[model samples]
Target: MNKARIAAAPSPAGLAFRLVFAAAAILLALLSLPQAGHAQGIVRGAQEGSYEGNRIAGPVGGAVGGVVGAGVGGAVGAVEGVLGIPHRHYRHRCHGYYDGYHRFHCYR
Candidate 1:
């Protein structure tokens, strides 16, 4: 056993593995996000603005609304998702100023 491995023994393999593993983990994590967002009621891509997609994302939204109201909700969910309606956007006003160069910054 030895001390100061960083200043003496920087294992390239270990460093490479760490970097590769971290990159892979981050990539996989990011790749799984969109699906998770959808599961969490995010209607992305094509189904962004469809009202039917709204039901699937609602508190009880599920494969139960047959595209409209209760029953065969899955197909409708798919169709609604494919409708590609633009999502509505609302504007809000906010103001902020930088706090410091070496500290956390927040906004309201």
Candidate 2:
């Protein structure tokens, strides 16, 4: 006797289960983010600290640096939030040309 393999199609229940699982995973991930106003500061501080620490020392230093950086960053962020200080973005645009005398000038 010879047996032939048959292809099977995914069922609606399986599809629904996958979709629900994906949605739940995404929701949980989003909910896990820091909700504090200083979240950005903390994140940036940790990253910077870790990088510097790792560069200057080693793994241990990186861990310590991250903790210290996070604390400092959170404090700064809180202070700025309370002070109502707005983040500033500066754009500098200048056009310059060199003269025959090798003199450079910029005009705005």
Candidate 3:
């Protein structure tokens, strides 16, 4: 094997492979630097829940909504069960009464 000839003529495939690997490594490093600066730090409060390491209102709101929804759902289910109809079978309406007089608006 002649070292001079091998050194003088580098394979195109080898050159292309090195270039692609180098580019990928540099791209990854550049992408990660911004993320390091923008690092999310933990936040603590009287109302303490962490979202991305920071305190957020999501869990509290979700819990409240879940409890309220369950109550409403139970009420609706009970009403349906008593009426001998499935939950979807019932139609709903809204009415405003005036001076203790009942006004009915039909909605189907």
Candidate 4:
């Protein structure tokens, strides 16, 4: 009777294949992250988050907005979700621009 070995070492080719697959998987995961994160930004922005990481207020007042709109807004707010709703002016009357500090500045 012959029995298969469950703890046998993998062949060089098999090991290489597994390593390549793992690397590819990791790379794809990393690459997809930014795209996914950008989508989230558009959402938080549409929801009246800061405009490009700026802490400016939205249609609602700053002191009144609280934790709801805590992300960047404006052009970043133009991104539509999977539902494809028009969010161009989701930030309301807010405008966005780069500040002298090389950071995004958004406000009414």
List, residue by residue over 37-71, the lDDT tens digit for candidate 2: 64688888889998899888899989998999999
* Stretches of candidate 4 exceeding 4 Å from the true structure: 1-8, 35-64, 71-108
Instruction: Give lDDT per model, in order.
Output: 0.49, 0.83, 0.48, 0.54
Clashing pairs in 1: 64-71, 65-70, 66-71
The number of residue pairs in model 1 that clash at the backbone is 3
- Residue 64, model 3: lDDT of 52
Q: Ten residues in a row with the worst lDDT in model 3?
A: 38-47
lDDT per residue for candidate 1 within 4-38, as digits (tens), equals: 55457888999999999999999998975434322
For each candidate, give its TM-score against the true structure: 0.29, 0.48, 0.29, 0.38
lDDT score of model 1?
Answer: 0.49
Q: Return whichever of 3 and 4 wins on TM-score.
A: 4
- Give the per-residue lDDT of model 4 (tens digit) for 15-101: 899999999999998975444534565456444433322355443443344334433342343344434565454342457877789
Candidate rank order under TM-score: 2, 4, 1, 3
| RMSD (CA, Å), each prediction | 19.2, 16.3, 17.0, 12.9
Candidate rank order under lDDT: 2, 4, 1, 3
Return whichever of 1 and 2 wins on TM-score. 2
For model 2, the superposed segments whose C-alpha errors exceed 4 Å read 1-37, 89-108
Query: What is the lDDT, from 0 to 100, of the residue 106 in candidate 2?
Result: 79
TM-score of 3: 0.29
